[model samples]
Target: MKMKVVCVGHRMPDWVDAGVDEFVRRMPRDLPLQIVEVKAEPRTQGKPVDALLDAERQRIEAAIPARARIVALDERGDDLSTVALAARLRRWRAEGDDVVLLIGGPDGLSPTLKSRAHELIRLSSLTLPHALARLLLAEALYRAFTVESNHPYHRE
Candidate 1:
């Protein structure tokens, strides 16, 4: 089963791109990881925030695979240990379904999207910028993979 990180924004800075690429390169081929950057909705003062979120929802939902297990990234979500993340990843892989991790934009995920997620996870308690969030997610997923395979990247 492949893992896909579905993000709202595209056109990351060079540094961010390099950082994400670095961790992604370390991911093993057995459970290949890929990134799908959906076009984020434009923020306009004229339109309600809900409207923008709805647009994002449509785009995100469209990108998701039918059987993919949705994992939403939220600040208020459960914070898991590296080992726990490894366990979840291993379990998802064993289920033989694609795992799709969702990353919302600056305004965050809408209630509709949140409600549809199979799980929600918070990478850090502190607020992080979108660019850093993607980098951290890439690193964490890579770490989870390493932990699952006993690669020594995560040490208790």
Candidate 2:
């Protein structure tokens, strides 16, 4: 069974595009991967940051599939090792669950969206730029799949 990765984020730089393209190209053909990016709202003068985050959250929620397992990329989320992520991916595949990885905008995901996620994953303890986070996540997903299939791409 193929699992889908839905990444929701705002405007991304050219570097992000390049990184995503490279990772997607290197991914195994057997694994069906889809990336969904939600446009983030522009912050206006005097406009609260929370409002912008809320808008992005709405967009993300609307795009997510009803049956998919939602996982939010958040700083306060659980930190898992690469091998553990691979194991989780394998289990999800066996259980026929499509994975949806959510990437929030600058201010991060809204409380509602975060609560709705089946799991919240923190990529690192240090805060990372949203654009960089997306690329890193794509690579991590690729690595997880490679590990699951015992591919040489993932060392240790």
Give the candidate number with the greatest TM-score: 1
Per-residue lDDT for 1-156 in model 1, tens only? 989999999999999999999988888888788888989898877988899889999999998999889999998898998899999998998899899999998789889999999999999999999999999999999999889888977888
> Across residues 109-146, which tens digit of lDDT does each residue of candidate 2 receive?
88888899899999999889888888888899889988
Model-by-model lDDT, in order? 0.91, 0.81
Pull out the clashing pairs in model 1: none
Off by over 4 Å in 2: 1-11
For candidate 1, report its TM-score: 0.96
Tell me the alpha-carbon RMSD of every candidate. Answer: 0.9, 1.8
Q: How many residue pairs clash in each candidate?
A: 0, 0
